[model samples]
Target: MSGAFMGPPWQMDWVDTARAARDSLPRRVRDLIDAVRAELVTVEDPYFRGVDNLPDLPEGCRISPLLSTVPSGLHVCHFDHGRGWIHYTFLRRTADPQIVVEEVFWQ
Candidate 1:
Protein backbone atom coordinates (compact mmCIF):
# COMPACT_ATOMS: atom_id res chain seq x y z
CA MET A 1 0.00 0.00 0.00
CA SER A 2 3.01 2.28 0.40
CA GLY A 3 3.98 2.10 -3.23
CA ALA A 4 2.36 4.08 -6.01
CA PHE A 5 0.79 0.91 -7.40
CA MET A 6 -0.96 0.39 -4.01
CA GLY A 7 -1.85 -3.31 -4.32
CA PRO A 8 -0.83 -6.85 -3.46
CA PRO A 9 2.20 -6.70 -5.72
CA TRP A 10 1.01 -6.17 -9.27
CA GLN A 11 -0.20 -2.69 -8.33
CA MET A 12 -3.76 -3.36 -9.46
CA ASP A 13 -5.76 -0.32 -8.31
CA TRP A 14 -8.94 -2.25 -7.64
CA VAL A 15 -7.30 -4.13 -4.76
CA ASP A 16 -8.66 -1.63 -2.26
CA THR A 17 -12.19 -2.04 -3.54
CA ALA A 18 -11.86 -5.81 -3.39
CA ARG A 19 -10.88 -5.75 0.26
CA ALA A 20 -13.63 -3.29 1.06
CA ALA A 21 -16.28 -5.43 -0.57
CA ARG A 22 -15.12 -8.47 1.35
CA ASP A 23 -15.21 -6.54 4.59
CA SER A 24 -18.75 -5.32 3.95
CA LEU A 25 -20.17 -8.77 3.11
CA PRO A 26 -22.58 -10.53 5.43
CA ARG A 27 -21.10 -12.76 8.09
CA ARG A 28 -22.36 -15.91 6.38
CA VAL A 29 -20.93 -14.96 3.02
CA ARG A 30 -17.69 -13.79 4.59
CA ASP A 31 -17.27 -17.11 6.36
CA LEU A 32 -17.95 -18.91 3.09
CA ILE A 33 -15.29 -16.83 1.46
CA ASP A 34 -12.79 -17.91 4.10
CA ALA A 35 -13.63 -21.56 3.60
CA VAL A 36 -13.37 -21.37 -0.17
CA ARG A 37 -10.15 -19.42 -0.01
CA ALA A 38 -8.62 -21.93 2.38
CA GLU A 39 -9.25 -24.69 -0.12
CA LEU A 40 -7.83 -22.64 -2.96
CA VAL A 41 -4.47 -21.89 -1.33
CA THR A 42 -4.00 -25.48 -0.22
CA VAL A 43 -4.31 -26.77 -3.77
CA GLU A 44 -1.12 -27.22 -5.80
CA ASP A 45 -2.00 -25.08 -8.80
CA PRO A 46 -4.67 -22.39 -8.84
CA TYR A 47 -4.42 -21.12 -12.40
CA PHE A 48 -5.27 -24.49 -13.93
CA ARG A 49 -7.68 -26.23 -11.58
CA GLY A 50 -8.46 -29.29 -13.68
CA VAL A 51 -11.93 -30.75 -13.75
CA ASP A 52 -10.59 -33.79 -11.94
CA ASN A 53 -8.77 -31.77 -9.25
CA LEU A 54 -10.95 -28.74 -8.82
CA PRO A 55 -11.48 -26.90 -5.55
CA ASP A 56 -14.84 -26.29 -3.89
CA LEU A 57 -15.36 -22.99 -5.67
CA PRO A 58 -19.02 -22.05 -5.67
CA GLU A 59 -20.99 -19.92 -8.10
CA GLY A 60 -20.31 -16.17 -7.90
CA CYS A 61 -17.21 -17.02 -5.85
CA ARG A 62 -14.60 -17.69 -8.48
CA ILE A 63 -11.35 -15.99 -9.38
CA SER A 64 -10.42 -15.76 -13.02
CA PRO A 65 -7.37 -14.51 -14.81
CA LEU A 66 -7.60 -11.19 -16.58
CA LEU A 67 -3.90 -11.06 -17.42
CA SER A 68 -1.07 -13.48 -16.61
CA THR A 69 2.40 -12.32 -17.45
CA VAL A 70 5.87 -12.38 -15.98
CA PRO A 71 6.28 -10.26 -12.82
CA SER A 72 2.59 -9.54 -13.16
CA GLY A 73 -0.30 -11.90 -12.47
CA LEU A 74 -3.61 -10.07 -12.82
CA HIS A 75 -6.94 -11.60 -11.85
CA VAL A 76 -10.57 -10.62 -11.63
CA CYS A 77 -12.27 -11.42 -8.31
CA HIS A 78 -16.03 -11.76 -8.08
CA PHE A 79 -18.27 -11.34 -5.05
CA ASP A 80 -22.01 -11.88 -5.63
CA HIS A 81 -24.05 -10.01 -3.01
CA GLY A 82 -27.35 -10.53 -4.89
CA ARG A 83 -26.82 -7.43 -6.99
CA GLY A 84 -24.10 -8.54 -9.44
CA TRP A 85 -20.45 -9.35 -9.77
CA ILE A 86 -18.40 -6.81 -7.89
CA HIS A 87 -15.27 -7.25 -9.96
CA TYR A 88 -11.83 -6.14 -8.85
CA THR A 89 -8.38 -6.49 -10.36
CA PHE A 90 -5.82 -8.24 -8.14
CA LEU A 91 -2.51 -10.09 -8.32
CA ARG A 92 0.41 -11.66 -6.42
CA ARG A 93 4.15 -11.70 -6.74
CA THR A 94 5.36 -14.73 -8.66
CA ALA A 95 8.58 -16.11 -10.02
CA ASP A 96 7.96 -16.97 -13.62
CA PRO A 97 4.97 -19.34 -13.77
CA GLN A 98 5.16 -20.31 -10.11
CA ILE A 99 3.15 -18.35 -7.57
CA VAL A 100 4.90 -17.61 -4.32
CA VAL A 101 2.68 -17.91 -1.28
CA GLU A 102 3.75 -16.26 1.93
CA GLU A 103 2.02 -17.38 5.06
CA VAL A 104 0.92 -14.88 7.69
CA PHE A 105 -0.75 -15.60 11.01
CA TRP A 106 -2.86 -13.14 12.94
CA GLN A 107 -4.09 -13.46 16.50
Candidate 2:
Protein backbone atom coordinates (compact mmCIF):
# COMPACT_ATOMS: atom_id res chain seq x y z
CA MET A 1 0.00 0.00 0.00
CA SER A 2 1.35 3.39 -1.02
CA GLY A 3 -0.27 5.23 1.84
CA ALA A 4 1.24 2.80 4.29
CA PHE A 5 4.63 3.64 2.91
CA MET A 6 4.17 7.38 2.73
CA GLY A 7 4.50 9.85 5.60
CA PRO A 8 5.96 9.32 9.04
CA PRO A 9 9.01 7.13 9.54
CA TRP A 10 9.71 5.38 6.24
CA GLN A 11 10.65 1.76 6.57
CA MET A 12 12.82 0.44 3.75
CA ASP A 13 12.42 -3.12 4.97
CA TRP A 14 8.74 -3.06 4.02
CA VAL A 15 9.54 -2.23 0.42
CA ASP A 16 12.08 -4.99 0.17
CA THR A 17 9.76 -7.53 1.74
CA ALA A 18 6.79 -6.49 -0.41
CA ARG A 19 8.85 -6.77 -3.55
CA ALA A 20 10.20 -10.18 -2.65
CA ALA A 21 6.81 -11.49 -1.67
CA ARG A 22 5.28 -10.16 -4.85
CA ASP A 23 7.87 -11.99 -6.85
CA SER A 24 7.35 -15.26 -5.00
CA LEU A 25 3.58 -15.60 -5.46
CA PRO A 26 1.94 -17.55 -8.26
CA ARG A 27 1.07 -15.39 -11.27
CA ARG A 28 -2.68 -15.25 -10.70
CA VAL A 29 -2.42 -14.70 -6.98
CA ARG A 30 0.33 -12.20 -7.53
CA ASP A 31 -1.87 -10.17 -9.83
CA LEU A 32 -4.71 -10.15 -7.33
CA ILE A 33 -2.45 -9.04 -4.52
CA ASP A 34 -1.01 -6.27 -6.70
CA ALA A 35 -4.47 -4.87 -7.24
CA VAL A 36 -5.33 -5.21 -3.59
CA ARG A 37 -2.16 -3.51 -2.51
CA ALA A 38 -2.81 -0.68 -4.94
CA GLU A 39 -6.34 -0.30 -3.63
CA LEU A 40 -5.05 -0.22 -0.09
CA VAL A 41 -2.65 2.54 -1.12
CA THR A 42 -5.34 4.80 -2.53
CA VAL A 43 -8.24 4.03 -0.27
CA GLU A 44 -8.25 5.60 3.15
CA ASP A 45 -9.84 2.57 4.75
CA PRO A 46 -8.71 -0.81 3.55
CA TYR A 47 -10.55 -3.97 4.44
CA PHE A 48 -8.67 -5.77 7.15
CA ARG A 49 -9.62 -8.38 9.70
CA GLY A 50 -8.17 -8.56 13.16
CA VAL A 51 -6.27 -11.55 14.54
CA ASP A 52 -9.52 -12.73 16.11
CA ASN A 53 -11.07 -13.16 12.63
CA LEU A 54 -8.32 -15.43 11.45
CA PRO A 55 -10.69 -18.36 11.29
CA ASP A 56 -12.92 -16.61 8.76
CA LEU A 57 -10.34 -15.85 6.12
CA PRO A 58 -11.08 -17.18 2.67
CA GLU A 59 -9.27 -20.26 1.27
CA GLY A 60 -6.24 -20.53 -1.01
CA CYS A 61 -4.81 -17.83 1.22
CA ARG A 62 -1.10 -17.43 1.76
CA ILE A 63 1.25 -15.22 3.73
CA SER A 64 3.76 -12.88 2.14
CA PRO A 65 6.12 -10.64 3.93
CA LEU A 66 5.76 -6.88 3.63
CA LEU A 67 8.50 -5.86 6.01
CA SER A 68 11.58 -7.97 6.53
CA THR A 69 13.00 -6.02 9.44
CA VAL A 70 9.62 -5.93 11.14
CA PRO A 71 8.47 -9.32 9.81
CA SER A 72 5.51 -9.45 12.18
CA GLY A 73 4.10 -6.05 11.34
CA LEU A 74 3.45 -6.01 7.57
CA HIS A 75 2.18 -8.63 5.13
CA VAL A 76 0.47 -9.05 1.76
CA CYS A 77 -2.83 -10.86 2.15
CA HIS A 78 -4.47 -13.54 -0.02
CA PHE A 79 -7.81 -15.28 0.36
CA ASP A 80 -9.62 -18.27 -1.04
CA HIS A 81 -13.22 -17.27 -1.66
CA GLY A 82 -14.58 -20.81 -1.92
CA ARG A 83 -13.27 -21.75 1.50
CA GLY A 84 -13.88 -18.36 3.11
CA TRP A 85 -10.38 -18.20 4.45
CA ILE A 86 -7.56 -15.69 4.53
CA HIS A 87 -3.88 -15.94 5.38
CA TYR A 88 -1.25 -13.42 6.40
CA THR A 89 1.83 -13.07 8.56
CA PHE A 90 3.15 -9.81 9.89
CA LEU A 91 5.57 -8.46 12.45
CA ARG A 92 4.47 -6.10 15.19
CA ARG A 93 8.07 -5.01 15.21
CA THR A 94 11.45 -6.63 14.83
CA ALA A 95 10.78 -8.52 18.02
CA ASP A 96 7.19 -9.61 17.61
CA PRO A 97 6.14 -12.25 15.06
CA GLN A 98 2.43 -12.69 14.44
CA ILE A 99 0.51 -15.01 12.14
CA VAL A 100 -3.17 -14.35 11.46
CA VAL A 101 -5.39 -16.51 9.33
CA GLU A 102 -8.89 -17.83 8.93
CA GLU A 103 -7.69 -21.34 8.29
CA VAL A 104 -4.63 -23.49 8.86
CA PHE A 105 -3.86 -24.19 5.23
CA TRP A 106 -1.04 -22.26 3.56
CA GLN A 107 0.89 -23.09 0.41
The clash count of every prediction, one per candidate, is: 0, 16
Model 2 C-alpha lDDT per residue in residues 24-102, reported as the tens digit of each score: 7678665555444444333322334445433222235444455556544545555544322223443333332223322
Residue 47 in candidate 1 has what lDDT?
A: 55
In candidate 2, stretches whose alpha carbon ends up further than 4 angstroms from where it belongs are: 1-15, 47-78, 82-106
lDDT of 1 by residue, 1-107 (tens): 33342222122132455556666777766676566455455555555545687667666555566555621344443444333243332233442222322221111
Regions more than 4 Å wrong, model 1: 1-14, 58-63, 67-73, 76-107
Alpha-carbon deviation at 12 in model 2, angstroms: 9.9
The alpha-carbon root-mean-square deviation between model 2 and the true structure, to one decimal in Å, is 9.9
lDDT for position 64 in model 1 = 60
* Top of the candidates by lDDT: 1
Screening candidate 1 with a backbone cut-off below 3 angstroms (N, C-alpha, C), the clashing residue pairs are none
lDDT of 1 at 50: 50
